[model samples]
Target: MANITAADVNKLRQVTGAGMMDCKKALVEAEGDFDKAIEILRKKGQKVAANRADRDSAEGAVIAAVNADKTSGVIISLNCETDFVAKNESFVKLATDLATLALNYETKDDFLAASFNGLTVADKLTEQTGVIGEKIEIGSYEKLDGPFVGAYIHAGNRIATLVSLSANVDGAEEAAKNVAMQAAAMAPLALNEEGVDSAVVEKEIEIAKDQLRQEGKPEAMLDNIAKGKLGRFFKDNTLVNQDYIKDSKLSVSEYVKSVDSNLTVTGFRRVALA
Candidate 1:
């Protein structure tokens, strides 16, 4: 067996981001051959990952990345089994790195399968799960593209939101951030009433009518009362119709118009661990 030196272990650790002990052990197992040592570590990770496959990974970090043009962005969540591990330095870095990699990916499936360093993302997550000794996974991913796109990761990195706007004009970027923040805070059901699912609208109306009936409201007034409740649903649950957080006097639509009359939210996605 080739004696593995500290330099050899550190070099391997730098190359693979594997733990010092793991790197040293792999180097000894591989007779100090660098590439072979990496393979050894990967196999170890694969084994651990497979063994923990059934474990629940519900805690982790949410991270967002945007391009220089501010016209594209991605929000991703890297989940682990424990809050302790989720807040680890290495775990957060892995989340950020995957988010950066998400820029070139069109779908979360492809991003997970995409290569990073010498390993696919899924492989890397498996590898890290071994290193971290936890069940880990990529929980959610969202890609945003439009004239203006912005993302916000709430304080704990447990919630993230991405907002896309129709025009990339003056104040668009700032407006986009405010809207993304609104999304993170208020969690509107849809961008607008037009974007609301018809079935969802029907469900809201039915629930409203049921509540009114339970309150002993007259049957003849049910239709009119439900209609009014439905209108309130649009105002409360739709992004554009909801009052802006900064200035409640204006709807989100009016607040955005204050930025640029032609600018408006085109799409949005919100991901939260809770």
Candidate 2:
């Protein structure tokens, strides 16, 4: 067996996120070959990680990147089992780099198979699993490209949003970014009422009527009551219809109107820890 020092184990532990003892054992098993040790750790991680699947992974990071030209943006969710691991510098860095890399991928499946730094994304995750000793995954990815694109990553990296805007304003990037941040914070479902699914609208109307009847409202008033509630739902779920966070007097659509910009939000995405 090759000699493996405590320093070597510590170095591996830092690099892989694996425990010190696990790192030492892998190094010893691999005869102190760092590359072989990494492989050994990954194999072990895959075996042990199966049991961690059910652990609540409600803490993680959302990362977003907007291209220099503001023509493209990507948002991704990198989920982990614990807040401690989610806040780890290594994990945050990984999430950032992955979001940057994912800009070239148009679909989630392609992104997963794409090369990340030196290894495939799946391999990279497996290696990270060995190091971090936690279950982590890429929960979602979204990309948008248009005349202008903007992104917002909320504090704590828990939420991220990407929005593509068609606006002629000189500061459209900044404005779109602000709006994207609002969308992430408010959890908007659509750009406007028309953008929402008809099925969803019908479902909401049904729920509204049921609630009104339970409240002892007359059947004759249910339609009118549901219509009023639907309007409120639109304000709650639509980006353009929402109350502007910066100014309560203006809706987001009204706020955007000041720039004389024909703002058409072509795409938007939001991701949060599940």
Q: Kindly list the per-residue Cα lDDT of model 2 for residues 1-274, writing each as its tens digit.
A: 7988889998988777788888899998999899899889888877656767676667788999987888888888888888998998978999999888888888988988999766789778767765677887888777788888888888999888888777546778777877897898799989888899999999999999999999999999999999999999999899988998988898887776655457666677888765
Q: What TM-score, computed on C-alpha atoms, does each candidate reach?
A: 0.95, 0.87
Which 10 successive residues of model 1 have the least lDDT summed?
A: 126-135
Task: Give per-residue CA lDDT, model 1, range 1-274, as digits (tens).
Answer: 7988898989988877789999988998899898898889888888888899999988999998988888889989899999998888877988999899999899988998999987899888887877777888888888889888888889978999889989888888789889989988998999888999999998998999999999999999999999999999999998889989999999988998888877778899898997
lDDT of 1: 0.88
Per-model CA lDDT versus the true structure: 0.88, 0.84
Best model per TM-score: 1
Model 2 worst lDDT window (10 residues) = 256-265
The most accurate candidate by lDDT is 1
Candidate 1 Cα misplacement greater than 4 A, ranges: none
